[model samples]
Target: MIGKRYTVPVITLAATRRDVYGKALAKSRTEGLLPVVVYGRKEQSASYFVALPDFKKVYREAGESSVISLKTPEGALDVLIHETGKDPITGEFIHADFYAVEKGKALRVSAPIVWVGEAPAIKLGGIVVKVLHELEVEAFPQDLPHEISVDLAGLETLESQISVKDLAIPAQVKIIAEPDDIVAAVAVAKEEEEAPVMDISQIEVEKRGKQEEEGAGTPEQGDQTSSP
Candidate 1:
């Protein structure tokens, strides 16, 4: 089991019932509201709106894996951030999808991996390589963890490594990934010397100089006298 758990922040959103397509969506952005949809077990998919700034704050803290409570007109809903849409030009949030989750229901989600403590091998010129960024886990909605912590302090030598089976998670949570899958490792950092860059213009000038020297050895047509 994890030694410490992060507190997931709760965010409230006002339910919107207005049109969600065409010009209405553009207007919603101008008003600082983002269009969002919520759907999941025991509920029909519904369109709604949330404050953009508030949602962005939650996104930065909770990310997509952590569960957050969404307050709708119906009541408080436990949900996970399923996905989000961004504007390509301005890099702004455009839309969001929240997956409603029921308490006591088991669901599979990708939990992010967080590395803690510096590997002792790093001081010996060893490079720390991350073998996996996230792990697939199944747990009840309330038991879902925000992130899995991997302690690098155990890596005392370059040959030391950690695998999925080494992770300490809550008993309620089950990692779906293979136990033999490597989570991280420390290895000797490969040092490569930079190769000298050749100057194309210098090479071209040298070739022209050689051609001129060869031409000088052979008399020109006009320079060729009767003694040719």
Candidate 2:
């Protein structure tokens, strides 16, 4: 995560029915915002709200691998987005789930895959293949890693393969994944030619989006995660 952090101030709002929540939620989402409820280990009810754009900025800073500070009127608390809702048409953010955290606690998060170095196979006109774009790991929120990088220049042929066991890790990071997991590998080289255009009779526009994913609850893990 190479971006600056953003602090969002949340206000308490009670929407008893879906009708009320819908109207408030719609208005919040329309202004690039969302409603969130924070329930932690203490079972505290911190029903709050936040702006989508503000959440995005901090989420980017934490790189999705670590926890961030959630600033509220009461005080500042560490947190991570457990879930978020996005607009279907504009593909913008709406509401998000904020999970409480502490730096001293152990947590698990996924790290993004980073391809480093130009492979000899790539320069040899081989098609570079990317696999295992993200990985799940457990660690302290403060110790969460931004990404895991694998150097491809060492690969001499298509037979070369890099597995999760071969991944380089910092001393502070512990490996908790299976060693046999394939991180990336080189495929046989392919040749590329100029663009070939064809007449299109049918075109279907599809929205690119993702569903909110929860952590299935935090467990003791020691793996790295991705960039913001």
Residue 134, model 2: lDDT of 84
Residue-wise lDDT of candidate 1 within 55-94, one digit each (tens)? 9888876777767888787788888899999999999999
lDDT of 1 at 132: 90
Summed backbone clashes in each candidate are 0, 10
What residue pairs clash in candidate 1, if any at all?
A: none
Stretches of candidate 2 above 4 Å error?
1-20, 189-228
Q: Candidate 2 at residue 49, lDDT?
A: 64
lDDT for predicted candidate 2 compared with the true structure: 0.64
Worst 10 residues of 2 by lDDT: 203-212
Q: Estimate every model's Cα lDDT from 0 to 1.
A: 0.82, 0.64
Write the residue-wise lDDT of candidate 2 on 77-143 in tens digits: 7776677677699776666666777658787888887788887876655666777888887766665
True-vs-predicted CA distance for residue 171, candidate 2, Å: 1.9
Per-model root-mean-square deviation over C-alphas: 6.4, 27.4
